[model samples]
Target: MNEDLTFLVLRQLQANPKQTQLQLSQAIGISVGRTNYVVRALIERGLLKAEHFRNSKNKSAYAYLLTPEGIDTKARITARFIQRKRAEYDALRAELDQLTAEAEAEGLLPQ
Candidate 1:
């Protein structure tokens, strides 16, 4: 659950990291409380950081940004995700091929 939440938050942030927590919650369709919880966890994990700055419209707001360590961790997590996906794809392909061969041998598929 944490991994899924982290990935979802990362994807959302990657899209528009300048968004405030409220804005991010709106964009991501999550409750503000949930977003805050996840964001805080990410910050604690060293996967995110924020700097408060006065916007033209709001004086007490923050903009979250990824640190160098955050970027590195993102890269690593993305790579691992792709690798796992590829492995699943390969496994599915093998299973499909095996099923096809079995069906063909059983005259269930066209020669």
Candidate 2:
């Protein structure tokens, strides 16, 4: 999975650990197979831990949680994600400004 997806999955897990793969897939707009693959990768990388427990509904389920290392990684990745998005936003803002100026110069833009 890409860094963006990894960061998103980690963030989602932090938000709700008890969510099932299907639920996560639906929430994240990814396929169930991709969610399953990502979860397995995280487990193998020691970034996430899957604990089986019986929920209040009396059904066995897995709660995907982050380990200490995972938490630390998540923090770092979140920072990076923020930086990337901010840079993209800045670029878009700059482009919009340029486009507006050009349009205004040509009298193609409304005041």
Question: Relative to the true structure, how large is the alpha-carbon lDDT of every model?
Answer: 0.81, 0.92
lDDT by residue for model 2 (9-100), tens: 99999999999999999988999999999999998999999988755564658889999999998999999999999999999999999999
Tens digit per residue, CA lDDT, model 1, 1-111 = 356557667877877777888888887778999999989988998888877766546665777788787788777778888888899999999999999999999999997
Task: Tell me which residue pairs clash in candidate 1.
Answer: none
Q: What is the number of residue pairs that collide in model 2?
A: 0
Off by over 4 Å in 1: 20-33, 56-61
At residue 93, candidate 1 shows an lDDT of 100
Clashing pairs in 2: none
